[model samples]
Target chain A: MEISDTELMLLGLVAEMPRHGYELEQVIVHRAMREWTAIGFSSIYFLLGKLQKRGLIRAYTSRASNRTKAQIPGADSQISDQESEPNTKPRKVFTVSKKGMRILKNQALRSLREISAHYSSLTRGLLQWPFLSREEALAALQDRLEALRSEEDRLSGLQLDQQPLPDYENAMYDFALSQIESEYEWVKRTAEYMETKPWN
Target chain B: MEISDTELMLLGLVAEMPRHGYELEQVIVHRAMREWTAIGFSSIYFLLGKLQKRGLIRAYTSRASNRTKAQIPGADSQISDQESEPNTKPRKVFTVSKKGMRILKNQALRSLREISAHYSSLTRGLLQWPFLSREEALAALQDRLEALRSEEDRLSGLQLDQQPLPDYENAMYDFALSQIESEYEWVKRTAEYMETKPWN
Candidate 1:
């Protein structure tokens, strides 16, 4: 069973630890998931609802959140003491259900088995290069090579904040780094092939 | 001037040889354009209409096509021949306009120059692998390695048919080959990494 990309990301994050929708939103934004996957802040709630209805995740109230909220100060002296009240925070954090784990495992298996392709419009344009001059094609491919390297740098520079990077994250980083480097090498090769393969 | 994948293909094919819709459809199917690009049989006419309206292509009569239609075996022979009289075929053969060539050239430059990422689902899934078990992940990676090799073989064995493969086609094949081989190596490296990387 194939889950949507957003669902997969959400479940993956939740399985790491129970997270509120807002926290999940922040994590996705920080990681720039929107650029890669078909997801946005607005769609987060709707997908959670759908996932919950399907029993992929369950909502839990977090007392830890309530304690954190209660730590806020209320002015000075008697004013603070007399006015203190229960912070009453019932943050609805979500944790992945067993079904979600099964889905994630299956999705991973399918993705790994699926054949990769250059299915972008850019590749499409490259495939049908009839009118493009060799000079223009060379320039364009060079520009792509430059861009790929910059992306490689960006991925390599990614930080996991103050926490030690998890093994899975290292794996993910390694996977992404390998792909970017592979594509960088590919664009360079394409340029060489284009130079020899004339369209006249 | 970002042409849709179908439009790019249609223009490229029409530019190759003035062809009717059926001929274009057959070429796309034979080339497996739909597998790599977002195109379908149903959208063929719709894209043709859009392209024609945009002055990227224009319909014209071809006496050669008319002759071909006339050669079709008549189920009603003499009666059809008498009715055929002038054999007024309304075939809408299309050829690329000057503007279409310009668009194709420009689209190629833009696609090559633009940065590429997550254009495929595999990249997105790899970005966020958290909950999956190491055992399952290793198994999946191994399976992917097998699939990638067979795909590599399929691409390597692609026959250029009676015609010598066009320069542009060779570039496309080489580009595809490099990517698959790159991925095959990447997965093997990843499986090795997974074996060493602990999930604690």
Candidate 2:
């Protein structure tokens, strides 16, 4: 299937639990989906509709503003305005159909089995090192190092804003930060090498 | 200018040295360009035409089997049949025009400035942990771990095939292998976590 990364992520989320749009938005934010993709809070419903149209997910209705009553696992992390509002109308909730689970497995396997380092631009720049003077290459690596350090700082601040998260919720952030740290270390080592070695 | 990564890399190479289509293919292979991008032996001429259409590159004619006469660097790496066979037809040589150089630097800056961790499927898989039972998740992670180990083996074999390479020439393979190692470590850790933790 030609499912987008956003669509695939949404399918996985809906497969995990039948959630209303607003609740899905809360889970998306809770999982920090925005860090990797361009998925926005506003697009959740649209994606859900698309998923349902494709027969990958089915939509049902449920009473509103009562996620706690539904016994959502990460109740503390749910942050939808509608989830707390008083006496709202029933909302459309989504669950993964059998076809959805089937495709999710197929798609997830396609994703997981294909371990490509999709960070192309960095490798592009690295391969073109010969184009840069020694000083320029050094400067470029330094610039990258600065960007990574600030990115780390930005992520750490994000964690601070969501204090007392569940272990799984925290694992999502940890994976992102760990990835950043790995790149940061690699760039630092590269810069060090650039400084010592002479490339003209 | 929304140039694809192939166009950008082509721009960089042409800007570095004026080369015929055959000579460009040799340099691309020597640099292990195929490892990242899908520029095939046949497409170099097509890309050259595209570059010339945009006035980023200019074409000139040079007799075949005369690259040494052109003082080509890394002459030993040139593998194109036309470049070696005697008395072949004149071939089209590409040189980066001034406009090409300007655009190349601009595009390179754009490429280097952006950094995204493109490993989505693994993260997608992790966030959907609740969709699967503890056993299923464990099985999936184990399967991923197996794929990663085989990937490492495959990359190591690639490096071995190109023996006695220059340090700069070998950097491409090293970068690829290091990326595999990072993912291997990450998947291994994730599998271990899956093993110890129970998710319902």
lDDT of 2 at A54: 93
| TM-score for each candidate, following the candidate numbering | 0.81, 0.73
Please write out the lDDT profile of model 1 over residues A1-200, one tens digit for every residue. 56787788788888889898889999887765664566867989999988888989999876674454446676454444345434344578899898888887687667756755556544675775666777887888888888778877776676444136665556566666776677677778667866876456
**Second chain alone, TM-score for each candidate:** 0.81, 0.70
User: Can you give the lDDT of residue B132 in candidate 1?
Assistant: 56
Q: Proportion of native contacts in model 1?
A: 0.55
Task: For residue B86, give model 1's deviation from the true position in Å.
Answer: 17
lDDT of 2 at A63: 70
Best by TM-score: 1
lDDT of 1 at A181: 78
- iRMSD value for model 1: 2.7
Instruction: Report the alpha-carbon TM-score of model 2 versus the true structure.
Output: 0.73
lDDT tens readout by residue for model 2, A112-174: 555544545667766666655666656776777777788889888887788886655566677
Colliding pairs, model 1: none
